[model samples]
Target: MTTSSTQQQTSDAFGYKWARRDSYESPAVRDASRAWLLSRYCGGDAAVLDAWLAGGPKTILDAGCGAGFSALLLFGERLRDHDYVGVDISSAVEVAAQRFAEAEIPARFMRADIATVDLPPASVDLLFSEGVLHHTDNPATTLRHLAGLLRDGGRALFYVYAKKSVVREFTDDHIRQQLMPLSDAEAWAALEPLTKLGIALGALEGTIDVPEDIPLLGIPKGSYPLQRFFYWHVCKAFYRADFSVDEMNHINFDWFRPANCHRQTPEEVRAWCTAAGLEVETLRVEEAGMTVVARRVSAGATYV
Candidate 1:
């Protein structure tokens, strides 16, 4: 596809057709949500929760809550009366509501945009988001909105994309522009060439040994097909998918079919904190991007 067509195609996919948004809500997805919850809150994510627990917050907000998978982290545990609220923009809340109620875990959830959802200012004690912000039209603005919802001295943890991370970003754009415009079945079929190409790239000796190294250009590994392997691996990094003949098909469908996705960097994140009037308490940039804990300066901190 021409670059212009690709751009136009992706924009169309990102278009907020309310019904389409509603339709995408409960599509059969592999259990990435379960693995994601483990890796985030208790695995790598536990560090985030530990920080808040250390800070002794009494309330928490899981912005962009999606299916409320992370809420499972605190199941059956004493929360010091800290209430965790998970919010998402999709009707996935209905399914999540049933699951949580069945599991005997009660959490408050609402359907709203994380960017402008209204809540009591200075009411929340902590905010947590993972791989959620960049999908919005304005991540920085979203940060400002969420930050305003926190109580003084309350902290927020965020994970977002990084600069110079080219592999998936390239393939993501390529698939959305070149591939997502096709019907679901057509898009699924179009992935064959990309799959063959990705297998070929996966065969490269040691090219992918480092997280930052992507044979991104001017090589057999640089083709759109090869990039598909990169996407699969990056995805598997966060999700434990059941390996099946149809697994690649499923990954391709999710990666390409998603109407919108975005990635950001540590520096850009810090800038967003500054621009949003937040004082970052901590920020660690790893190979993927950044893990940040920031607070609104007006909110005073209290450990006691």
Candidate 2:
């Protein structure tokens, strides 16, 4: 298939998947619930977010902002003060709108591909695209496009999956190919075994000592926490005990359903930042792969 055609297919698939965000994320039903308030700050350190927002009222763009979950985390109750724009390529934008409205957050959601989305040049103060670019047909090019949206000296953060062990990589590819032909319901049904396996492995609370290095796959021989190793090598990284069965299924579907999920090496991610003239503030290889925070070198310079 052509590149544009592939991009459209990926977007449509995400559109379908994210419309069921409540199934996965369980967005708050009412304004008073603890889930409602806590969901706003889920999965991130508040102090780090505060540091990012310290500059005050800047134009923030959440590229691939799925269901406004990140927006809730980023803006919280102070939404009226920040200029936040969320662009996505799915019906999830509508879901995001509803969720934000429920929270009384004055955030806007637009349905558009982040790669081709048009905005004023050098207009964004902070651009956040997590777990989004790697699903695009061309991650490097899409990343450059995202970088172009930032004002020179503006900050941006991204998360992409890290390259995995060769065994795991092939297993993921095989499972994804099998799942691709199945309907969402069928695919979820098919993934139950894997999820159960993950649950079983998580129960084995012990450490794994990798006595020999697998140089071919770049897996260093070391003492790895068993839970982390199980997640890193088996079960599609679905070891979170707190997630409900449906939520775990959602994670499984997210991994196997996407048509274009790319994993990159640390060197490649660093190279992209360098090519875009973004000075790296931090680059961490966490469970999600690589999380990078970078700033454009100049205050208003174009990235072309």
Candidate 3:
């Protein structure tokens, strides 16, 4: 598919996903997500995040904000303290606007591609793009464009998927390709079996000890839970006992329905940051992805 078509498909998939907000908006899920976000961005200290938000950043940009969930999870009432702008490539921005309106929060929402959105350069003080860059046509180029909108010394916090085992990577691509032609509803229905499989695998309480590292497949030597071993080395069957079946399916659909879900290595991510004139402050790498906190160092810098 062409880049534009791929992005459009991705946008449509996410729009459908976000519209079913109630599927994943339970209190338990919100708390868990908030804790994870804090751990990654604020060193597990809510005070750190609070202080940063109160640190005189007058304007905040939520790039690729899907239904404003991340912003709501991160900022809460503190969002009212700044001029918040949410830009998304899909219709989810409408949901975001309605949500903020109902919450009595003042904000602006725009439906536009973050990579080429018309926003004044150096007008933003804080930019947040959670799990978004990887879904773009070119993550590095997109980052460069978003970073250019930040003033010198402004901060950006974003996340991207990390490269997984060779088998898992291939399986992910294969699944996504198969779902590309299906409507969003059909794709969601198709993922139910995978979610059930994840539950079944998760129920088998056992661990496997790999005798040694299998570098060829990226399987490290260690004891892994049965479900996790397959999840990390084979295909993604996201399982969390706390989440409902639909919630689990929501995650699976999120992973498999998008056409532009790119995964990258830590080295590549760091290079993208450097090329975007961003100075990395903290970069946390996990089996799933990388979370980054960076500050803009040069407003006019371009990707090399």
Candidate 4:
């Protein structure tokens, strides 16, 4: 498929996903997600995140801000203190605007492609793009463009999916290809069984022992939960007991429906940051993806 069409489809998928705001806006999910975000970006310290937010970043850019969920989760009421701009290519920006309005938060919402969005150079102090870089046509180029909008010494926080084990990678691609032809509603319905399977597997609450590492498939010798072993090595059937079935399905659809879900390695992500003139300060790798906190530095600056 052409890049434009792929982007449009991806945008539509997210638009549909975000429109069902209740699926993600529940208090339980928000609390859990906030904790996860703190762990990733603030070293698991709410105070640290608070201090950083209050540390005089006048203009904040939430690139690819889906329904402004992450921004609300991260900034909360502090959103009123800064010039917050939320940009997205999908219609979800409308939802985001409505949400912020309902919450009495002041923010500028723009429905524009972040990759080529026109913003004054060096105008933003903080750029937050969570799980969004990889969805762009060219992640590296998009990163460079977004980084260019940051002032020197400005910070950027983002996340991108990590390349998984061999079998999991194959399964992910296969599922995505199968869903590509379906309408949004059909694709969402199609994933219910997969979500149910995850629920079933998770209910077992069992464990498995890998006596030997299979380097070819990236399976290491260790003790893993039954569901996680399959989740990490075979196919992604996300299972979190705390999340509802629809929420779980939402997560799966987010993974499978997007035509632009790109996965990257740590080295590649670090290289992209360096090439974009951003010095990597923190790089956290998990089974799912990579979370990064970087600072914009002088062009051609040596990386340590």
Q: Which portions of model 1 show Cα errors greater than 4 Å? A: 1-51, 54-57, 73-81, 164-168, 183-254, 299-304
Q: Worst 10-residue stretch by lDDT in candidate 1?
A: 236-245
Compared with the true structure, the alpha-carbon lDDT of candidate 1 equals 0.58
Error of 3 at 92 (Å): 0.7
What is the C-alpha lDDT profile of model 2 across 1-304, one tens digit per residue?
2247556656766776777766565533222223432332333455656666676788889999877775575457756778889998777788888888887878877888887788887899888886888988788888788888888778888878888887678888899888877776677788888887777777787799989998886577889878677666653747566666666767777787777889999999999888877888888775458878888887466542
Tens-digit lDDT track of model 1 for 38-104 = 4544454545466566644377788876555445543335343468787766665555566567767
**By TM-score, is 1 or 4 better?**
4
TM-score between model 3 and native: 0.95
**TM-score, per-candidate, Cα-based:** 0.67, 0.85, 0.95, 0.96
For residues 113-232, could you state the per-residue lDDT of candidate 4 as single tens digits?
999989999999899999999998889999999999998888899999999989999999999999999999999999999999998999986699999999998888999988899888
Candidate 2 colliding pairs? 152-298, 162-289
Worst 10 residues of 3 by lDDT: 295-304
Q: For every candidate structure, what is the RMSD over all alpha carbons to the true structure, in angstroms?
A: 7.2, 4.6, 3.0, 2.2
The CA lDDT of each predicted structure is 0.58, 0.75, 0.90, 0.91
lDDT of 3 by residue, 54-117 (tens): 6564789999999898888888888888899999998899999998998899999999998898
lDDT of 4 at 181: 92
